[model samples]
Target: MEVFSEYLIFSARYDVSMVTELDDSKPEIKAVTLDLWETLLLERDGANEQRNLIRCRNLARALSKFGVKISVDRLISVLKAMTPWLLTVWEKNREVTHLDQIRFIIKAATDGSVSLREEWLDELSSAYVSAIYELPPYLNPDAPQLLRWLKDHGKKIGLICNVGRTPGFILRRFLKDEGIGNFFDVMIFSDEAGIRKPHPEIFRMAARRLGVKPSEIIHVGDNLRSDVWGAKNAGFKAIHFSTRKGRDTIAESDPNSLISISRKLGGLKEEEIIPDRTITSLAMAIEGIEELER
Candidate 1:
């Protein structure tokens, strides 16, 4: 009876140890979230400038028709003035609405000296949102294949993008027009989420919508603060996409813009925060994620 009792105790201890080991094992990766601007879509040097120009021209015409008689240069000046504010809000990881942006342009152009009638406000907002079609950003050469590969491997895909002059509706259309809209299982924009990346909550939101835990997801992007630091702080595995040359283009053509300053990895200490993997080529994305998995 004593020998039997000792054998029972050993079996119970072994079973508990096995269960604890399984519990501590890393969860399987169930989803991938990517940054849209630099990670998936590559913008040319002057696309943003051109898009704003188009908006100013369109708004000037609209204002003239509405008897407001605003000049394009006036509109340009207002936009330039707002750049600092935009950077300030973004640095705080806060977002402004598209309507508020349009209202600012009008408020600045009029110097609060003139007020447009109710109907004109709606007309002006449309002019602001529709500029992306006039001058569009191009897709990253390898983004489509990378997205497809993720889908084929049974990974849920998502996009967490920060919208600037161009808004989310237009960006969604651009994605569909570029033939990659159907690939994503989820899409989160700062304008819509009311919270931007590096906030941790936004990352958690994506994970919840993608039906996975944060630990079971990997995020890929070009920006260090917004993408890498954001994901890691939220308990996600991150892959830094550093290809600025060749086919794997990441971020805008110009990296010195003020907006880039707060988001990208310039003059920042890289010793404290680090990505689980870094891939220079989008083709090596699979390898990067696989390495993180192991």
Candidate 2:
């Protein structure tokens, strides 16, 4: 079966087609685990630049109260230099929490000479979280409908997302603000779990929370490494949501990124980590689920 939309076309040309055929007769998909960023939500255009500015300004403000004054330019430079360290942690399937990030920034900026009170750290983290409001991530046009469809069909739903910059707590609040929070039966964040995706443990954690075996759930996401590779390795059917708007572009552009590293670890073959199905939009997730139900 083919599913198409104005923004996407679904096909079964690769190993995904074979996986679909194999699972066609025994559809036990009782739940769906979704990736948060890019899968269900998108950062607005120019939001990244604006958010970075807000972060620098807020960090500066937070530091001022603690008798540490720094220019936003210096703060930005320190934060930019931390990206590789952050990526290194993620590559090891661990997440650096927002608190840890704040601590690192403070240490770097102060040259390890100053110690902040707990209250000050909280103030800084709050400021960082609030910056998201400048350009909040909005749901994909199809996310609400798809989520509702899954819930109405009696399928359990969960979110297994890798947190970056914005922590899982804030993302949960964002979900509630967008009016889709109640749809998930379980929500797991990499920072909170201490294990990022492409790691089987995180997927298994979601499965345990949902009271289903990994094989009984279908994991959907826009990342091939963390989403597809992780879920498949965990024994869950997987869907590669190949939306054009998300992190896929970054992976496509950089040959040495985490996703690239993951692809290499999967034997440098696309088919080795190919998802059970591929859809271009959230709107097509329902179709992929339906095909699996067949």
Candidate 3:
């Protein structure tokens, strides 16, 4: 096993070939923990772009009602500058609430010279949430099947998601709308939990809520550092759902985002982030879990 500051990666050899059946006799895992974005849900093509435009427009409109008068371009730029700070908070495994985000933007818009009323902040947050609601991301096609399979097989399922800008309350509503909310026995969102992944606390909390030991829970997620390293550190088995086929593609598409997030969060090497198993799609999760037990 390759050990990093916060986690250990077990080196194992197994056939990566697809398995078509689950060995009903080998049901050792008591629970399963899943990541939210990219694992069970994916934004529709160009959905992110559309959401950003809507967010900017709504935010600008909200500020206008407060007589703040910030242009959409300026709002976007202020938000972009706040990304690093947002990352910094996340790196600490801490969550920045939606209200706090709006406060920061308002501060930036006014060059640190203005303070908005509490009612105004609430208005901005609601507007932002409304925009997000208008363009909710759809779930991956295979997600419902996988989630149902696990639940029907008597495994306690939980969701561990990192949130920024959007709160956990909103996400729960989205899950219900998509018809998978009932599958999760427990849902832990960073904003609600006050800690984000790569943090052992978050993983441990999920295990606690599910009434299972960390060793008896398998965490499946797409991000190497956040999901794999975090779960491993908490003594849980992990499966990496490489949605883009491989790490190379992920790095190429968003070179700085994940790497920088990992670095700021501390204690993960590329090698240490390796998972016990890798699945290219969510449909493979069932077999992957069974294989791990074997």
Highest-lDDT candidate = 2
Model 1 lDDT per residue over 1-294, tens place: 999999799887788678778987877999999998767887666666677889999989888887787899999889888877777687778888777777788888999976656788778877888887777777888988899889998999989987887668778888999999999999998888988778898999999999899999999987777889999999899998876542222124445444444455434676766888888867788899887776
List the candidate 1 regions with Cα displacement exceeding 4 Å: 1-24, 245-258, 262-268
- lDDT-better candidate, 2 vs 3: 2
Cα deviation of 23, candidate 1, in Å = 7.1
* Top TM-score hit: 1
Reference-based lDDT, each prediction:
0.81, 0.82, 0.80
Clashes of each: 1, 0, 0
Better model by lDDT, 1 or 2? 2
Worst 10 residues of 1 by lDDT: 245-254
**Where in model 3 is the C-alpha error above 4 Å?**
1-27, 245-267
Tell me the deviation in Å of residue 191 in model 2: 1.0
lDDT of 3 by residue, 151-188 (tens): 78999999999975678998898899889998999999
